[model samples]
Target: MPVNLADQLKQQALAQGFAVAGVASTSAGGRMPLRTAALERWLAAGYQADMAWMNNPKRLAVQQLLPGVRSLLAVGLNYYVDQQQGVGVARIARYGWGRDYHRLIEQRLKRLGRWLELQQPDSRWRVCVDTAPLLDKAWAEEAGIGWIGKNGNLISQSHGSWLLLGHLLTTCELTPDAPAIPLCGSCNDCLPACPTGAIAEPFVVDSRRCIAFHSIENRDDTLPLPLHGWVAGCDLCQEVCPWNKHHAKASTDPELQPRNWILQSKPQELKEWDDNQWDEALRSSALRRIKPQMWRRNLGCL
Candidate 1:
């Protein structure tokens, strides 16, 4: 059972539009204690806010996601766009400024998975996108695609943290890459940059006080004060990260570019948008996750 498909698979992933790709050997139990424990503590403290899916036991072990998984082919797509948005416009997070990222990354990953399957017909494979139970950040770090930044984002030295990640787990073995080494020795700029102090500590985010959570995920009638002009998602932490500030580049993919409507949107205009208008504007964009009520609620706060 000699296999040397890692190099070729990585090349295929790149050709499929992934910014970076790498492979990592999977642990049999697929449990990382630090991550599991941190999650437990976060949940126990009610830091997950209303996101009840975070309580899933499967999140602690990727083995539950895909039994007999042997190796993870991790891929990242850079989605950064260096466009100037109106200062008065209600802010949409960088990821939602364009087309839905889940669709973008999943389509590319499914192609990679097919390539992997063709090489090893006997291989069992599962594709994991953002909504999957797999720990994408940890696996991507283990694969050396990037290190998990203090802001809880996968930070690639070459591409910063503005990346959408996906994973393909297969029973087939591939040469594993070395784990990435974090370079944020003492830098803590992202900690205080949060308008709502969502970064509880280095890598832990408290969703309760997070503006992004309140804006997009929270369903309550009232949200915490001082949304800081964000109507959909917040990027303050990433904006302040030195790695992102200095090394981040505009994504070459035109699909990831910000929509003209979003760039010129005003709070008043968004608040006035009817459900039909909202649907038409957000048809293919990830920002559609924000319901009409949520949009008006967030806009009201702004």
Candidate 2:
């Protein structure tokens, strides 16, 4: 029997450490318009904060991102780590506790893209991570990898909201998976759990008030007085979600494991580290993006 290319591709993705994978049609015949409208409203309300790239035209449609695209191959990597930060240590989100996901996931995606090209030599492809202007969570939900939860994170039945998403846009036609239905019915736990009130409403996050946004993306020397203690990204919303409490598990992948310092260092000790010491400590870790100065600033706030 001839092999189904889509199935083979999905198998390859799973072997490459992606916990979940699915394909979605790029024909623009489904919920994309609704997503676009929601995004437009969010941007209009200044919910994206200083992330102006969210307004890029390519984000609205797959065709704009990769011409001749026929299918979207979405994959999820679970980065949940079962560990606790030491007392008086700055809290970092679970996602950033390990190596930078972009670097690790992109390598897997590149391999997948190459394998697809070998199977269909003439097909064009584009691999995208978080840096791209693509609406990855929406595409991931559409592809059936997971559903978007009330906290705006992709929540898998098996992985909860601890997924880091990536996707490939290709010209090769593939079988589209069924879209995932919203599974966060009546679960408003995340909204009230957010310390900064970032989740203004179900499925709507105002980045201006997001701790992750202010800690990681805000370039200002001083963050809001209320947002402190989070040295990197924030996970309070996901931590409070019932799905995570039951479904989230520690990732077995060594590449996603947290660094020793991230899990056990005291904030006061980190604050005393000079530039050279900070660089050595973080090295290739995702928290390196916060910068030495920002690190001190965040620690000072704590």
The prediction achieving the highest lDDT against the true structure is: 2
Q: lDDT for each of the candidates?
A: 0.86, 0.88
Q: How accurate is candidate 2 locally (lDDT)?
A: 0.88
User: Candidate 1 clashing pairs?
Assistant: none
Question: Model 2 Cα displacement at 267 (Å)?
Answer: 1.0
TM-score (all chains, Cα) for each model:
0.96, 0.97
- Which segments of model 1 are wrong by more than 4 Å? 1-3, 28-31
Tens digit of per-residue lDDT, candidate 2, span 1-302: 12488899999999999999999988876677788889999999999999888989889877888889999899999998777788877788888878889999899999999999999999989999999989898899889989988899999998898899999999999988998888999879999889888999999999999989988888888887455567888888888989899998788899998888888888888888999998898877777788889888888888
What's the distance in Å from true for residue 284, model 2?
A: 1.6
Best by TM-score: 2
User: Residue by residue across 109-148, what tens digits does model 1's lDDT show?
Assistant: 8888888888899998888987987677988888998998
- Residue-level lDDT for 22 in candidate 1: 91
lDDT of 1 at 43: 89
What TM-score does prediction 2 earn? 0.97
